[model samples]
Structures are given as structure tokens and as C-alpha cells.
Target: MNRDSIFISHATPQDNEFSIWLTSRLEMLGYKVWIDKEGLLGGERFWVTIQQAIQSSAKVLFVYSKNIVTNEGILKQGIENEIEYAKSIALQFHIQDYIIPLHIDDSPYNLAIGLPNINHIPFNNNWAEGLKILKKKLEKDSIPQIFDTSKSVMAEWYENEYISNCSIIPKTELFYTSWWSVSDLPKEFYMYQFSNEVQAKAIRNSNQTIPVSLMSNVLSTFDAKLSFVVNRDDENIELKPVHTYIYSLNDILYGFESDKFPQHRDVENHFKRLLYRVVSNFLIYKGLWRNEMSNKRLAYFLPKYEKIKKIDFTYPYSNRKKSKSILGKFESIGMWHYAVSIQPMLFPFVGFSLKSHILFTSDGFKIIDDDKKQHSYRRKKGKRFFNEEWRDLLLAFLQRLKDDNEEIKIKVSQEGLVMKMKEWPEMFWSEVGYNDPNSKMDLDKIEDYYEEITEESND
Candidate 1:
């Protein structure tokens, strides 16, 4: 037996030409549209057949016009009887949103008053184009899930090699999440985690939600500046960056430890390969692998090399220059005035250096020199900076989140109607605390917390 077809209920005997044209168009698009003139057969129990057709169809299309709505002859069969019967069948089966109205060259505004949110198609204005819109809306509204956008809404600027690698999802769901982009990166990459529907909508409407990439950049940027602003007194806590070392193999780096497990062996070999062309090294410690331990990290000497770069800057492109290591302060040396352009390569395992181009050696991402005498690392230049469009986009997004949070913290207070956040005893000697009288006692605790935070943040 054939499944029921999509029914087109219209005041059609008077408007027969339109019914033919409309049915023809729908048929071309492969919809088995049931027009009453073609559908009604002089058979046994015509009313039983009509009621069964109404119940089984996935969609009901009501084509409305000027004369048929008020005409008693048309209303008697199509609306007052047939369409009304279809709706009763829909209610019995608990079908929601089954009635879609296709409006014609009449008072379309007045015709659809007080009905449920009827999905209407503009048939009179542009016949083919209107049908296209109707078809898209019909297909989209039919889906069982929300955020089903059959039409293209996301921007194409985010469509390149970079986006494909990073997008956690395909096209963004419209009903699930609204467009809340701080950077021009595609909406497909952003989603608020939610345990339920209520929470999902709540986060979608909030300004506080921050992108993950932007958060990473802000922590990295602030680390450079806080180093200088903080070293005020001998009692004051001095911020020290957690030292990091990247092996040549792993894109991620490992800490200096003497373990000889398989994991450590992999990391050591990864970092060791950078040794060939990058920098000269001195031994920090020697390690023994695997005799007392499982087949873990291999035994090798950890090297102390020159710090080639200091990049303490925020998103929007700003950096700080500072030299830090055990050897430099004892020699009374200040930070080096290194060549500026090569600075970005100094990320990860930055060490102290007098030789120029040390930053490039660390992470210049070298290619063969072509003459084959040497391998030179790669550096971003010219359009490469502009091409960091993803990074820049990530920055702007984080700034919005930061700005919103700041606004939330600053509250208004009273006294002569003069508002101030400085109510914590104007001259009390300063330090970091929630309610403590002085900040002095908490400096060491704060420093330890800062170290832990930076470590976790870097990872």
C-alpha cells in the first residue's frame, strides 16, 4: 500500500488554473501533493478515504485566496467541512504544527489572524522564488531537532585549511546557540557546555561566556607585564615564571626530570633533535634510565642553553623583554637589546643568549637551506603576521569576556552619594587578601598559588 501524500487543501473549483500550476510545481520537486480535484474518487465510503488521507500525510498545505474564504459554496466543502475535518484528525493524533498556509493575491495579512503560528509561503509575489523559500522552510521546520537551519547563515571567512582542523562541529545550530562571536572565527567552533536545555539557552544569552583560545592568550600576555610591576620590596613577592623546555619531537614540552620511562624517552629524543642546529648546550644534570625502573624515560643530560627571547605581551600584539636564568643575575647583566622582529620565535623554552638569532634557532621551524650546507628555521614575516587572523580573532573575543567580568566586579556604594571601591581603610599597608588586615602575611602563599596557577595555565 502507498503511504499518504502531502495534502493541498484549497478552495479550488473556482481557482482551478492556480491549483493545476501549483500542483505541477510541487510534483517537479518530487513531493506527492494531493490536490482534492485529482484526489477525490467516486468510490465506496469517500469520507472514510478522505479522513484516512488527512491522518497519514506528513504535511497539510492550505492555499488561501480572496473569494474562496467567504464563498459559502467553497467553504462548504474545503474549509467548513474538509479542512476542518483534517484538523480534527490532527488533534486526535496529537500532531502539532501540521497546517502550513500558502497565501495568494489577497488580504494575506487579515486571512491568517488568530491562527497558531502558521508557516506561510509568499506565492503571489514571485512564483518560483517564493516556492524555493517555502520548500526550505518546510524541510527545515520538519526536522525533529532544533537549530536546524537548512539555509546558509554562517560566514564563509572561516572556511580554510585552519578552520577544518579546529572546528569541533559542523554548521552551527540556530535554535541551540545564537551568534556570540568576539572574533571572526566561525560560529561552528563555539558552544556553551550545558547539562540541559535551560542552561544552554542561558549561556547563549549571556555576555560572560569566553572562548577557550582567548583565555589562553590573556594568561600568556599578562605573565610578561606582572614580572616588573610586582617586585616592589624585599618583603614583596617576586613573580617567577615556571621554567619550560620543549623537546624537538613533541609539540608540547616536558619538565626536567630524570625518569627513564618510555614517555620520557620520547620527550627527551624530541627535545634532543633541536640540538643539531639551534643552540650550543651545557649539561645541567645526568640521568640513568630503566635499571631500577620500568622501561620508562631514557637516561640523558639536561642542557642549559641561552634564553633567546622574552615575550610577555597580550593579544593585540604587545610584548615585554626580560632575561631570567640562574647565571645572568650573578654576572650583573640586564636584559639583552636583541633584534626585535625575531622575537615571536622565542616562545616555549626561552633561554639567555648573547648570540643574535637565538630566538630563530629555538623555534624558527627551519627548512633546508637549498645549497644543503645548513638548515634555517622558519619565521613569520609580512603577510604571515596578517595571516594570524585566527589568533587576532581569538584575542578580541577574550577581551569582551574580560570587559564584561570587570563590569560585574565594580559595584557602587554610598556616603554623601559619593561612590567608591576604596572603602578598605585608605591608608592600611597593602598586600593580597580577602579580609585580612594586612597583605604582608599572604605574599608567600600568593606566590606559591601563582606558581601553581602558571603551571596549570601553561599546560
Candidate 2:
């Protein structure tokens, strides 16, 4: 009749020995331990008995092993369902760490069920030490701290009466309108990087940096607003006033991935998790634009993706609404040809073939006309980019596979796909010559052509 039973949730037979030993050890520490082996009789309903044991137990200990992670048979043994029910009960009571994970093997953290980030108590190397740690944790029932607010009845009343009744309609409406306003862009930014060492020296000599207004003005040329700016720390040595610009990379990436169903929080979380892996010498420019960079010349340069080679640089003419049908089709077809000509330097995948064509829409690039068979080539929508950790891991892994054999295939993990952005270093800084405001490429003429195209299309 012990109500303080600690339930051991594990795969039977495989984990049978460990469960038996753990039960005995916990019982020795003055705890009532419940295992399916001892709790259920022959005639008992299997599910009802499990539910009752789980309900009666104060804590659920998930026993993790190598077998549990890889063996499908073990998962089919009904322990996953028990974990699910335990999670449900924990959620109902608003519990934290109600189900503790104990590890008996060195499986990857991501492999453990319902415990990706949680630090599990390791019993792999030293069982006695892990048991001691568990004993200490369970000494006081592991109750979460709750602040007593019995004397704050008036405080609660004030919040309920004033804050709850406050009208936030105007603020909420303003947010929606502001988002759409920034989102509506007439031109795409086509960024280009320059290691223009000559220009770098000139900036250093002048002891001056690009004006803060430069970024906004450049964005406005395309009728776009500032989205996210990743500043280079060492650039402060040169003191670029433009580096002061700061916005959430998470928000910008989510807007790119999905206009209909954006996972804002997920984007935020992944960026935060992988922020430390980013080196200090890089910058990212994100905003509402049809292209990655513009024809306007500028001083600052965006970082280049060192890994990718022969990226498709051309974009759809900004004023597509005004272009003649023949001209538009020609331009679009030209872009598709350019896209097909490019090849991935790091990951070799046959993308632009005879059957498939790359289409440049207003928002971003798409590879279509192949019955959606280009999943391997394109980044899945809603995935954030610039994951340094994942990229490093994948490259190393791929190289290892290549070393083993000439042609080998391996299953792609979620981490690999999540960091797979379609085209990285998507925008480059508007590169120009030293002391000359204009570059050798003549961006002004390019701009003029776009203007003329727009006018003709309008006519």
C-alpha cells in the first residue's frame, strides 16, 4: 500500500536485469520501487495495471540503453507508450523533470526518447556513482519550488481588474500592419562580396566607415526595409557606423521559409542553439527583396560562403509586371539556364537537368517542372540556414564516407536537413573600387536597363 512508488520504465528482458538491481537498490534507500515484473499477476489486464502503477508512482525513471535506441523490436515492446502516458501525466500536473532518464550506454543525446537536451544520469561507467547521484536527487521527493503568495490577494486583484481589462487592439493591429509594410518589396537585393584589398586599405587610411544611413538608403533603392544585419566584430576596428544595425536573424529566416505557416519560435531556438559556432568575421543581410543584391554601389561587403562554388547569381528583372511577354520569358529562361549551369562544389547533386527548370519568383528561387523530384537539391521550406555546427559535422562525415568507398550512400539525419539552406551567402555587399564610388561592372547601366524594362512593360 505504498503511494511513493518509483516506477522503472524499461524494455523487459533486455533491461530486466538492470531493473531488478535498481529496484533493490532504491528499496534499500527507503523507497517503494515498482517494476512490471513484480507488480503484475498472470490474470491482470496488462494496460490497466501499467496505468495504475504509473499513476501511483511519484517518479518515472526511463532506462536508456544502446538496444533501446536502435532496435525497433524494443520500441515495439510497449515502453514508448508508457513514456507517452508518463509525459501526458507530467504535463497535466505541470511537472518539470518528473521523468528522469538514466543511461546504461553511450547513445547520442538525440537518440533518447523524450530526452534530447536533458542531461541523463550516466550508469554506464560507474553504476554505484550514478546510483548515489540518483539517491541524492530523490532524497526530498524532488519537489519544485513554489513561491507562497497567500498575502498577495490585493496584488492579484489589481492585475485582474486593470491589466486583464486593458485594450491592446491598437498595438496588435499596428504589429500586423508594420510587418506587411516591411514585407512589400518591389526589387530584389543581389549582393556581391569583394576581398577588394585595395579598397580595404583606402578605408583604413581614411579612418572612416560607411554611414548608418547607407544601409537604409541602399535598401530603399529597392523599396525594401532593413530585416536582419549580422555585424562583424572586428569591423568595429574600422568603425563602420552601419554595424550598429541589429535585428533578429530568427524572424528574418522564418519570413523567408514560410509566408503561410511560419515557425518563428523554432527558428529563434535553432539560431540561439548554434550561435556560438559562428565566427566573428561574417555578416548576413536579410530583408524583403526580389533579388539578393542591388545595382547601387556601396562600400561595405557581405561575407561569401566559402563552401559553395558556382552559385546562380542572376535574378528575375525586378519590374516583371512591366516587361513584355517575350522579354520576360527570355529573361526567365536565361536565369534557368544559368541555374542549370551551376554545380555544387561541396555536395554534388544533379539538380538542374533537362526535365527540371529553376524558376525565379518575386520572393525566392524555386526548382520546378520535375514533378517535385528535386527535394535533394533544394532546401526544404521553413528550415533556417548558416548552421556552422551542422555544416562542419556533415562535411567531416561525408569526407569519411568518401574515404571508405568511392560510391556510398548514407541516410541523412534531421540535423543535416535542418541546416540545409537553399543558397547560403545569399546576399553579398555591394563591392566597389577604391576611392571610386562606381565599380568596373557599371551597376548604373544595369539599373537603367531595369528602369527601361519597367517603363516598357507599363506601356
Candidate 3:
């Protein structure tokens, strides 16, 4: 049976043209449509083919016209037969909308004869308006399952990979977690807990209802940013953290932990390979899986330059002028800066580097080297630096720095911008160097800058 098909039942010559046109339109929208002239081939029995087509179709479009009501039942017997069969099946299955009544010219008909109480889709001469109504009804009547989209891939991964790995599912309690990101919002939107729909609703909806479609789309966009597949059993959909290793195998660098430090070069490489897989997964999620950026690829783009070339990592530390495990370049471009950093290789803890590039836009930063791009979530229309996104990122940064955690860091240039964000009293004392009441990074300086910018804008 063709579940994605629609069967059209209509009277002769008068309705034939409309049926043909509707069939073409439905076919274009990815629906397999069946009409008498289209479905009936030379040798096939008419009634048998009609019955088969009706049985196969998920919906039936019964076209109504002045001729049907005005004529004696004998003239449109085939269409009447199709409607009777459809009505019987529809009633047996308790389906209310199996047959979609389509009408033109709003001709009055006593629907009590058949298709009683069923709503009609008015497709009167205006095909455009009719198509819109038809398309919406088709979509609403179709499958309830989530479509396979690039945006839903992460959610699917979270459901499959992440959920399958979990041994237990949490219930009846809210727990703070990270790793799963709700997209279309700032990165900080994921940094909270919710035990039920109410909590979820509370977080997003203060007074207005937050559209789940928008939330889902935005969240799917950041699925790669999610380091771990969110455990399905987790009542609150707790996002699991993506972990990396350093001087150890299975040592959780980002979320959870289990350390295994190996001394042998071959064993170390084995662990490094595993860690690279994790990073590669994230890179894929970030949409940056280019051949040039692959771990095995020996060549790397020179940080500030567009030039792609191989660089030697064998030079000894003290003898070389630039002898750091990590190499990076920062170049200013207009109000933004293009920054590229080559992280030191993991295995030998010596020379190999994974080159990554980032673009620091005026409002936020974006990772440009990977297939999955990660960006700072910033509000486009809002107060200069006092929006929720800014506060969330700032607070997350301050919390990390306050705890002396290596998980997060502040860029010097970006921190200067942060200092300027001190117009908000809550944010003022939280500035990096503002721990001391008397400090060089003064609150007054931020106030002065804020006033200057405000004055300039007003002028």
C-alpha cells in the first residue's frame, strides 16, 4: 500500500481537468496520485484497479461539483461507488478525514447523502489559494515523525548513540548539566537544568510561549558543539560532556573522567588515536571536516597567511627562537580579528599540531576551520553589551575563572571589551581584574567609555 499517495474521485469530463491539474500539483509535492485516466492502463479491469488504488492511497480527494448534485446517480456511478467504498473504510477505521472533500463555485449539495459533516477544501478558480490550503492539510495529515534533516542528525545521534550507551535513565529530579545545546539561542542556553516540561517552559517562557520548532532547529545546529550524546533516559535530557585526554587515556578533559596515562610510544599513539576520534567527531559536528584539517593531513595553513604548507616540528626548545608546543597567529581585520591556533599534538606530548582557525566578529566569535561552525550566541537587536547572551557567556567565563578552572579562558582583547561591559553593576565587579576594590582595570573607565559611546551614538 502506498501510504504517501492520494486517490482522486470525481465525475466525468466536467471534473476531469481539475483532477488532472490537482494530480500534477500533488505529484510535484512528492505525493503519488491516482486518477481514473492516469491510473487505468489498457488491459486492467476498471473496478478492480479503482479498488486497489483506493486501498493503496492514504487519502482520497473527492471532488464535488454542480453536476454531481443535479445529475441522476447513474451518470456518476463510478465516482459514487468510489465514495461509498471510501466512506465504508473510513467509518470502519474510525478515521474522520480519510476523504478530503474538494469543491468549486461553492455549489450547494446535501452532504447527508455521503461524506456527511466532512469539511471541504474550496479550490474555486484561484488555484494558488487552493494549493496553499491543500498543502497545509497534506502536511498536517502526513506523518508525525521528525523528518531526516541535517538539523535533526544530532538529535538523532543523541537519541541513538548517546542513549544506547547509557545504562540508566534519570527520573523525577532536575540536574544541572551541559553538552546538549538548544540551538538558535546563545551557547549559555544549554547551561541549566529542567526536570519536566514546566521547568523547561519556565526557563524559556516567562510570559510568552517559546516555539519548540525554533528551539529544535537552533539546538540541532549546535549538535556538534555537544561533546556527548545526551542520554535518552535522562528525564531532563541531561547533555553529556565531550571528553578529551592529556597525558592519559580515557582521562575526561571536558566532562566525565577515567584516566590512563601510558609511558610507551606505541600505546600512547593508540590513546591519541582514540582522542583524535573524539575531536574528529566534534569537528564533524562543527562542520569543519576538510581534508586539509584532518588529523592525518600533514600540511597546515600558516596562521595569518592563506598559504598552506608543511612545517617542521622537530626543532629542540632552547635552540629555536619559537619553541612552543602550540603556535598561533592573531591578525586584526576591520573591527574583527582572524585568529588561527595549532594545538600541540597529543601522543608524544611533543610536536604534532592540529591547526584550527577562528574569526572574531564584532559581536561574537566563529570557528571557521571546521565543517561544523561554533559561534558565540549574540543578540542582534539589543542593548550594547547587557543582553542575556552576553551575561550568560560572561558569567560562565567568570565562574570558570573564579574557580581557577582551565576549562575556559578569556582572550586579552576580548577581555578589554568585557571591561567595557561593566556598565551593568552586576557585571562590574565580576571583571577579571576587579577582584581588588582598588585596581587598574577600574569601573570608572568602563563608565567613561559607556558614556562616550552613548554620547557619540546619540549625536
Ranking the candidates on TM-score from highest down gives 3, 2, 1
lDDT of 2 by residue, 1-459 (tens): 334677788865566546655654555345666677532212333888888998877789988876564456345446677888999988987767778889976666665455887669887654555676676677556522222334333234334533355423322110100000011212232111113434333332332211111211111111123223232554533322231212243343434444432244433333332221111111112111122212221111111213222211222222322211100121222211111111111112211111112223221233233423232122221012222222222222222222134322211111221112222122223333122112111111223433443353256
For residues 1-459, write the lDDT of model 1, one tens digit per residue.
Answer: 233457677664555445555554455444565555433221233566666777667677777676456643234344546567767766877767677777755444454343436656776544444566666665565522122223211212112312344434434221211112111111111112233444333322231222111111111110111221132254543333233222332222434455542245443333233221111111111110111111232211111244532222242122533222211111121221111111111122322111111111112222122321111111111112221322233222222223223321111111111111111101222233122112111111123433443343256
Q: Give the distance in Å from residue 299's predicted Cα in candidate 3 to where it truly belongs.
A: 70
Query: Each candidate's TM vs. the true structure?
Result: 0.28, 0.29, 0.30
- Which sections of candidate 2 miss by over 4 Å? 1-3, 38-45, 69-74, 140-459
How many clashes (backbone atoms < 3 Å, residues ≥3 apart in a chain or on different chains) does model 2 have?
A: 14
Q: What clash count goes with each model? A: 21, 14, 13
Candidate 2, poorest ten consecutive residues by summed lDDT: 172-181
Local distance difference test, each candidate: 0.34, 0.39, 0.40
Minimal lDDT window, size 10, model 1:
284-293
Sort order, lDDT high to low: 3, 2, 1
Tell me, by lDDT, which candidate is best: 3
For candidate 3, write residues 1-459 as lDDT tens digits.
335567888766566546655654455445566677633212333798888888877788888777564345343566678888988877777765898878754566564275546788876544434556777787788722222334432234334533355424444322221121111112211222234434443333321211111121111111113222233355434332222113322331223333542224433344334333333333333223232333455221112223322222221222532212112333322122212222324333322232233232222222244232212211111112222223233223222222134222111111121101111112111112211122111111223333443343356
